[model samples]
Target: MAVTLQSLETKGLPPVNDWHPDFCGDIDMRICSDGHWEYMGSPIGRESMVRLFSTVLRHDDDGHFYLVTPVEKVRIRVDDAPFIAVSVEQISHQHVFTTNVGDKVILNPQHPLRLSDEGAGVPYILVRDRLEARIHRNVYYELVNRAELRMLDGQEQLCITSGDHYYSLGMILEQD
Candidate 1:
């Protein structure tokens, strides 16, 4: 079924956060690393369905991801973060990120960008309600171009400023 902003607004998304549903066992659904959703090992081709499922996705305290509803909670496999930050826009003093699942997040203290070098310095930004979105390579490059060096905790660091807050990308080491 086609989903529109109007339709979503009228029906509204289920409050998965407030629901403490029982576990309904694992489902053959997976969200690929590239932000594609799959079911029974085949890609879910409908954007609307993906969007709908995204609304119910949650990360439990045990670090497991689940698709939740009022009565059922189904485990789903996520290779990485469930959402991907596909694009970014700078407006005034804030950098806004647009996720593949259609979430708009403003970079601030609450939604900070984090860089981890586990696999060549992957970048992620908090999107909503404790969920994060992996920053796409092209968008990450754009952010790097705008990065500036600043002194942090008595050490030089690469950082970015948004919403009047300075977010440190990571510490910079001086060569001998």
Candidate 2:
């Protein structure tokens, strides 16, 4: 199948969620910690190719990453996350995250933000089924600057609202 942004946008991606493809052995492709896709110890320089592969990327229930198509699945290595949220933009009350792979996900119930301890509590946002994009440090800082204090579960917390849902960024200590 020819993987192109126009083709994917028009025809949509393959049903990776429902198709249980056979494992086709491991590939020497790795998503580096900085969101660079590397193959055989060399970085994949083609942005189009990277975006195309990102469409087929999946995080399976077995806690492994794979490049999944309708006919086959090939395991790949992910040093951190498969995608990186390089930028963030606010559209009215909604926060939209743009990934390095060219995916834009709005913060909502289905695509929620989470804090992980991988990099001393770095933030992540779900991009699609089982796939997460690590928010870049600058974007995270922007989020933090836009956060507001709110009371949740009777405790003060730093939270942000998007798509009518409140996401707790972290807890806040009361100043004595």
TM-scores, each model vs. reference: 0.88, 0.88
Q: What are the C-alpha RMSDs, in order, of all predicted structures?
A: 5.1, 5.1
Inter-residue clash pairs, candidate 1? none
Backbone clashes under 3 angstroms, per model: 0, 0
Scored against the true structure, residue 172 in model 1 reaches a CA lDDT of: 80
- Candidate 1 positional error at 108, Å: 1.0
What does candidate 1's lDDT look like per residue over 18-87, in tens digits?
Answer: 9998999999999999999999999999999999999999998989899998889999999999999999
lDDT per residue, candidate 2, 1-176, as tens digits? 22332232244665778878889999999999999999999999999999999988889989999998889999999998899999988776778888998887888887899988654677889988889999999998888899999998888888988868898877786679
Q: What is the lDDT of residue 121 in candidate 1?
A: 68
- Candidate 1, 92: how far from true, in Å? 1.8
List the lowest-lDDT window of 10 residues for candidate 1: 1-10
